[model samples]
Target chain A: MEILGYITLTIFVGAMVLMLFRKLNFPVQTVLVVVSLICLVLGAVFRFFSEGWVGVILLPNEMIGGIILHPITALLAGLFLAGALTASGGFDVLKVLINKLQKTPIGLAGTLVILIQLPVIASLPCGRIIAAALLPLLFAFGFEGGMGLLTRSQLIVLIGAFARNAFGSCGPSPIGGVGQIGEGFLGAFFPTASEGMLRAPQAFSLMLGTALTALFLKLITMKLYPEGVSLRDLPEGSVIEKKKAEAKGSFKGYLSLVIFVAALLISIFQPFGKMPVQTILVAGGILMLFMCRVSIRDLMSGIILLPVTAMASGFMAAGALASTGGFEALGNILKGFSSVPFLGVAGMLAIFVQIQTILPLACSRILTAALVPVLYFFGPAKFDLITWPQLAIVMAAYMINATTSCGPSPLGGGGMMAEGTMRADTGYIKGAFTFSSMAIMAPLAAIYMKFLTLSSFSASGVQLGRDVWLIIEFTLVIFVANAIIIKLSSKVLSEDVDKNWLSQLPAFVIPGAMGGAILAFCLYEMAFLRIIQGAIGGIIASLLIALMVPKRLTPAETGE
Target chain B: MDCGTTEWLTFLFLMAFYLSVEIYQVLRRKEGEIISFAGPDIPLGDLLGTRANVRMKDGEVVDAEMSGCTLCLGRFEVGDRVYVCKNRDKYVVSLPLFMKGRRKRSDFCKSSCRREQASIQGL
Candidate 1:
């Protein structure tokens, strides 16, 4: 069984690498399905050599058992609601409201800041829906769109930050979110784990990470690679072009939006008891059809098949691996790393939690489904390397890293949508995306999980009262350190591609070291040596991530 | 974070602490006001953008013949699903044209507007 697991793991890793490279031109989900069959066949063959035909029969059931339905239904429901919103003019209503909001004390940039946070607040299952819906409106704020409300820089920052938040929103979504995958694993210990045990930590880290992303875009991306950005600055001495008003919303738009919000609230709070989230979302969609006058055809049009297919197929492959004992073999292999003197158990966990971000996938669901169970095995009940509470902390960090991994993926990722809107080169914003996730969000999430999320939500009631100050201190340190890095980098940042690459060396290492050490400390409490191991682990991870960022600008970028 | 609770307050605190400071610094330096345009709707009825064509500088808001829906004014990221409405009798763009077979008209608008439309159906 263990030998088969290693073979299955090899096949899985090779298939994922193949999917990441676009040279084959096959769809990712299709590749996942093919890999599942290969793993199953190998598993069946191994079983035949050992236990004959009877052992092979149960492999199919084990593979089938891996399919998780919660996120799939939630994704479908989210699309339905989004479709209704578009059909019923709910988005127009939001635009009108946002425009009005700009006049309030928050001012334009402040209003835009809140606007960037909307996807996370809405907690949509997919980022593209809201990104698609709002990105044009963000463009409308720019000179090209003729609103002339925001400069090219502000527009880039606004769209980029919003995209950053939107892509990661799925990590904390209670309704059919990818976080539910981890929550299900955690539920074995914490009874209330499903009640968004990971929400606040992800949300907290993401908010800060997003702000740093905006800063990085403004300071580093725009300055270092002006040629990379395609949005033209206002012509010299040209007066800003006159613009026009936005479309108005009707009563039905308001009512429909209200329904969407109500459905989200009900799903999150579960006010009527622990009904399946599908029931709440589908019920909301049905009510919108009747009350909001949205057509069923329009609702049907909203359901995107790609993400759903990606998730379902990913589950099938993961199930195949589990049935083949692939997870056990993978865990053993990873645990073996702890034997190295410099890479203790804490260091291994730090590296493990961050591996998804280190090698991002197009949709986080692909790797997350396969890896979280392996992470589950690291807990006290299985390997005894970490307690349940420590596992929760690592889960928060891992899940956020996984959710945001898609943002930097060059393979048709969610961040690509934002890049298209910005008209920048394909990999222009990747460095910022990778840096923010690795250096800021991961450690911030770990600390939040330990201090706040676990303190309140854990079933065993671990009181982490004394270290609450760490949260405040860590938040301030990350914010200040990242700000100074961007500020100093801004000094040497210019259009020279090679020079810009040279400039990023320090930016990647410093915060990454702090991030890793902080992550280790959060997990190990007072173990100084473990903390050093974590810093070494952080430095190594940061170097790999930094290397992956494109060193050369594309021809179009250089042309501009 | 929950609404109106300490957790919610904490969320707002973090948001205010980070976002407000960052945004205000940049925004306070930015040189513009809130400009509004036809709320992502292809301008219709009394509000057509016959002179406000959202294309290249040399192009007029509407084509010479002024055929079909003349409300063609919007922007989008490249390669996205675009709303392909007619401008000057000829289709002058090349992106993934998204003509939802069931929609009321064949005329397209901006990719973002169309992407927003398709985002409902596509994503």
Candidate 2:
């Protein structure tokens, strides 16, 4: 079984190499499916045959009644939804509208950051997506803002946003596929969701801490180098040929817009109770298909296999490492190392080392199986502080791991960001270090000071559940409000500005929509389905608006 | 004298160093660098126990081979020179060696380390 695991691991590595180096022109979809199957089989074989590998497999019994369910299945569902929303013209309209709004390089950067930050609480690409979607926009704005190939200030914001979203109270941080696997393992190993409500002030402070960190960093960088701009000015890019606004009064055009909006709303609120996310996804997909008359061929062609393949590979590798007692062995080894005054520092170092070698998801999952069990050596008194079974330390790990771009994982956040944004460089390394020091490390120190020392805060037993939900609600509200503001602001601003000014707005508006959409998903988990009826209500609302609006312009008069 | 926490910690740090070295080699190879050796530097043929015969891109056939080096990981054939990076990082040059191939830097660079070692020894 161990041998089989090794073989599967090899195949996974080979597949990545082949794809990356262009050794094979295989469709990414086919590659992922084949790789996933190979990994699953290998894991199953190893679990049954290898005595040391018992920890790798989630027993059938466990899955049937487990808290985590099947991690791969959940991940696939999330990917399918995100992919569908992306492929359909749903996000495109929002992107277009946003581009028409911000009108300045800084505004554009802010808008793009918001868009990339939206999928904070669910299955979205936090770092990679931002890089892919926003980097080019930043490049275009760069010339106008006096920024060049690499703007240190802009990189700081990028890192800040990545760190923020990666740890945004989401069930699983979106650092990469590795994070998903690690989160799943943790959920399975400790299958209890503690319930209770903490004071609203507690929630407020925690959020303020994170947000203030982001805001401060953003402002400092902006002040230091206010001229950083987008690469949209590059002559290398083919200029977008302006298109006329067609079907101004056409019911079909309005209907398409309504459907897109409806899908966005439904994705956020999930109107139907106990309805599979896929069901709503498929319905929205169908609306896109028929409303736009987009063929199934195009849909299939647009499907990407990178996320799925990465997810499966991570699951198998982590599973193999866990079950083989590799993590447990490491934990035993860590136990032999005595305590220093700074347990947090030691923990961080251990985590950093382990991740490069064997740890997954910043050791959030592995720690339970490995580190927590070895807490006896530290003495029972310090156990609670370090074990972090209370979810505080777990949460910290999620934040640190969320950016995943910095570490040694061959499949890491940095790689994902590079791939998504098509701009791969040492900028990410700088971003990681900068953000870690500014956001994660500094705040972590504060948290340690407040909670670990000078108070019995750990024993306060404050119900964090309510606080968490409120933060989720607040974040969602901010996203939606920001999106609407960007839209309205851009429209008003564009009327007074020339072509160049109008072009910058979309960068901010589009990211605002993304952030809004993600916040909506977070809201949905807070029992929002009871208040809304999913995409249908939003579609209906849009349709009614379309009927009432006056149509004054013809398609030809709109543009060239 | 004991394998206590401090000693084990030191050992772990060394282990990390070893791992980093190996990873760096792999990275160099992946990035397309040729492998080279120092001290008892052996040629590719000697490392691999097999000679490489290839026609160069410029339509020239080379018949030279390598022999035993001071250290070797596995088999490496001739017609491969050690590709060096801008920072002078060494890697193994394989097919179309002159035309650029993937880097196959080893985790261990005895020559580089030896230089440091000699500097320390002299000191």
Candidate 3:
């Protein structure tokens, strides 16, 4: 079973890599299907050899069980509401309302920050819904979109940062978020885990990561690969007339917007008792159609099948792996590494947490679903590699890393929407996104959980006052180290293959190693050997990760 | 058939819904807004020298100017770029007349435009 699991994992990863490098030419959905089917056949073969006919018949039970329908249904419900909003001119009303926010005393940068983080703050079930709503608004700040509020460089940062926040917002969302998967697993031990065990750490890390991503976009992506950026700065002292002269919306538009807000409030507050969110959203969508004169076609067209289908396919592959004990095998293999002198348990955990971030897919849920179970197995209930409190810290790191991985994915990532609007070639902002996830967000999440979040649970031998300072100190160091590396790398780097690797890889690896070690220490370890092993483990993971970072810097390097 | 009732229902619902959308789209397909090309009937009424998002015959919307005001064949054509200012409730486009076939530009959009330089920034 272990060997079969190993084979399945290898084949799954190999197929994805083949697709990613363009060695295999197929759509992302097709690629995933191929990977899943391959894993299934492999699982059946292994089962047949091990336990004859009975095992083969039971193979699909575990495999099929991996497909969780809650999120898919939730996604469809969210899309339905989004479509109705679009059809009824609720979006237009929103545009006007958001447009008016420009006059607030908070000023441009402050207003921009609020708008960038709004998706996460709202805690929508799907980030795409809010992203679709407000991305046009973000673009309007650009020269191409005709508002001219920001320079081209500034526009790139704003859009990129907003995308970073938007794509990861679902991680902390109360409404059928990907983080709920981790929370569900954690509920086995922690009584209050399901109430949102992973939310604070993810939210905290994502907020800071979003800010760093903005800096990275401005300092690195735009300057490093100017050709990828299709936007131009305006001439000095030129006047750009506003694109929408009136910025007015109709009565129906306003009515739909009101209902939209009402829907959000109802879902969040659950005003009418604990009805399923899908029910609320679908009801809201139906009301929108009637009041706003929206056709069913308009509602249906708003649905994007790509991410949903990708996740389902990912589930298929994961199911095959799980049915064959692939995750168990994977855990044993990593545990086997504890015997290796250079990489101990801490180091192995570091690499494990950062792996999904390094090889990001279209949806965070894909890898998160596969790996969180294995990470849970590492706790005292299983291999005893880490305690429950320690597990919480690691889980926090893993959850944030998993959630934000989508920001850097080349395979139909949500960030691609921002890239399209910005007119940058694909993979333009990938470096900033991956580097921050690996170095800044992962360690930051771990430290935050260790100090504050896990305090409610009986995490022994920790002082509040000391831990608070340590959190601040660690965050500053990680933030400064990463920011310096990015800023310096940007100065020398170009978007081409050779130029991109020249400094970027080393920068990523060094910080990734540091981040891994930091996470190990945050697991409440003061030992020298564990820390060194953690750093070494981090280095190995970072190397694989650094190599995986996209090499396309220029428009000429657009296609795989 | 292999999955649960929810999955079956979801699958069926999506198929029917999308099929209907496709049918609706095909049924409702129509041409772009057909302005009268400013013929004698309309007489280019206050549309001259104004920067309007005019759809070309190819259906590409461009910041366009009316070719003639007086002699008035009265159709919109794409130009180097357009600058516009408010004219009562309308916006009149100010473009450098293409007297000698387009005043020289800087090769391509340097990612900057006159439209992005103004103070109004978001939304």
| TM-score per model (chain B) | 0.19, 0.32, 0.28
Most lDDT-accurate candidate: 1
- Each candidate's interface RMSD (Å, one decimal) is 17.4, 24.9, 18.7
DockQ (C-alpha based) per candidate is: 0.03, 0.01, 0.03
**Model 1 over residues A21-90: C-alpha lDDT tens digits?**
4333334566677789999999999999899999999889989998876566666566556666766778
Interface RMSD of 2: 24.9
Q: Indicate the DockQ of the complex predicted as candidate 1.
A: 0.03
| A422-441 per-residue lDDT for model 2 (tens digits) | 11111122222222222233
**Model 1 stretches astray by more than 4 angstroms:** A413-425, A459-468, A555-560, B1-123
Interface RMSD of 3: 18.7
Candidate 3: list runs displaced more than 4 Å: A236-239, A242-246, A269-277, A286-293, A412-424, A457-470, A487-500, A549-552, A555-560, B1-123
Candidate 3's error at A111, in angstroms? 1.6
Give per-residue CA lDDT, model 1, range B17-112, as digits (tens): 323323332232211111111232211111111122233333333221111011111122122222222322232221111121121121122322
Q: Please tell me how candidate 2 rates in CAPRI terms.
A: incorrect
lDDT of 3 by residue, A435-505 (tens): 77888888999999988878766546567788789878988998999888887787777546567666777
